[model samples]
Target chain A: MTTTEAPAPSASVIARRLVSLHGLTRLVLFAGFWLVFAGNDPQSWIIGAPAVLLASWTAERLSRRRGRDVTLGGLLRYIPFFLWESILGGTDVAKRVMRPEVDIAPGLIEYKIRLTEPGARVFFLDSISLLPGTLSADYRDGIAYVHALDADEDLLDPLRRLELRVADLFGERLGGEPDA
Target chain B: MNILLDLLSVLLILAGAFFFIAGTVGLLRLPDLFTRLHALTKADNLGLGLIMLGCVRFAPDGLYIAKMLLLWLLIMASGATASHLIAKRALRGDGEDY
Candidate 1:
């Protein structure tokens, strides 16, 4: 019973900020990213809390519109696996960069989505770009266009694995048949 | 070993200070803000990194050092992110280069 919805003014911004806040893959590679961001000033949380107070609001709204809101517990479940992948991603980037023959086959790719939230979808796009050898070309209409340096199985494999990890966190399914 | 660590710390702090001063000067003298940010951010990031490295050297053990280094990473993330956000905003406002 879902219908095409009307756009709102703040939706534009919520959409963008959602992308910025949710994508942690890149920073995760950098090591304890948010904890570090919080470590430095100790005062950052002060400004950040209020600035981001609106985020929870927008996230809920996005979920209502799109049908998925990532609960804190669900999002946190993948942290360990995500950390391991970050280490592997760092090595992958180093190997590809150092190797002379490994020419990167970069191009846009469309990844299908199961989550209905536009914000959550954008989050997925940003996190994928954070990995080495892959950049997000774009995400539109529930499809993510991923650009990879090497368009081989490895690239797709990691994303597949990552999607599973995220799905496990959110209790959703990805790239499987619809039993309808 | 203790003496060596102290010397290392001194050298690192001095080197970091040098880089910071150079970056500050570049920020003051560069003709464009982007260029200024270029000099400032890169230098500041590495400068703080070295200073953190030096502090870690003098610390009691690796765990304490890791904690301190974690602090540096935090500063870096915020600094880099803020710089980018500010630069993007400035660029939109008819860009005040330098």
Candidate 2:
């Protein structure tokens, strides 16, 4: 039998390849997560290693189908804003509930989403519920039906701002106005 | 310094408890399921967050603080999701008054 000889790849080249591999990236991420959750205990690594591997493998398969990645820096910026909004939302509802008249003109507002990505669209819908006086009721065909505590309140502006923020988080620029 | 930290933690926890009570009041007093959901999510999230903040101040290690923060985040996500589902159901005529 004749053996074909090939040039050996350099160590740096091998490491670069491994780092770029999606499965390996996910494995490293899951392993880090395991370390954190296991409280950095070395003894727990025996159990954590297999569990993290399996979890990362499954997550890799699922993420491959979806194929979207969020910017962690963007997410970090979004959190404080989201927290403040949540506080405002809670306070607004509390005030309304405590008032004697309970003056609310509840109605459905149809909002047309301009974000093209499905992940961004879903996030937008979920986040709407956390905003003051708005709750997302249904989403279909690129349109989201939101229930407003006061129909007269100008929600579109805030919603648009939120859309832009979400777009920024996804490293995508939003184009065009949200349908009124 | 120790006494000051203790006082701050007590204040934070008390504030959190106040929000929890307010949320409960809103839940019982709100007219519709949708409005009630709004109160519950907002109040409870803030309440728990404040409590977690207090706990963070007392936590001996960074890891414990991180875990507490993680718990708060999980609670916020679950609360939002649960509110959405309930609102959706209410819209579907599960309750007409909402």
Best by DockQ: 2
lDDT of 1 by residue, A106-130 (tens): 4445566555545445555545544
For all candidates, state DockQ relative to the true structure.
0.06, 0.53
Please provide, for model 2 over B11-49, each residue's C-alpha lDDT reduced to its tens digit, 9 standing for 90 to 100.
989878877887898889877777777778888888888
Error of 1 at B70 (Å): 10
The candidate that achieves the highest lDDT relative to the unseen native structure: 2
Point out the worst 10-residue segment of candidate 1 chain A by lDDT.
A23-32
Please state the CAPRI-style docking class of candidate 2.
medium
DockQ of 2: 0.53
Segments in model 1 whose C-alpha atoms lie over 4 Å from true places: A1-68, A100-102, A171-180, B1-98
Show the colliding residue pairs in model 1: A36-B74, A104-A149, A105-A149, A106-A148, A109-A146, B32-B97, B32-B98, B33-B97, B33-B98
Candidate 2 TM-score to native: 0.84
Fnat (0 to 1) per candidate: 0.00, 0.56
- Error in Å for residue A96 of model 1: 1.5
- Quote the lDDT for B87 in model 2: 74
Off by over 4 Å in 2: A1-29, A64-66, B93-98
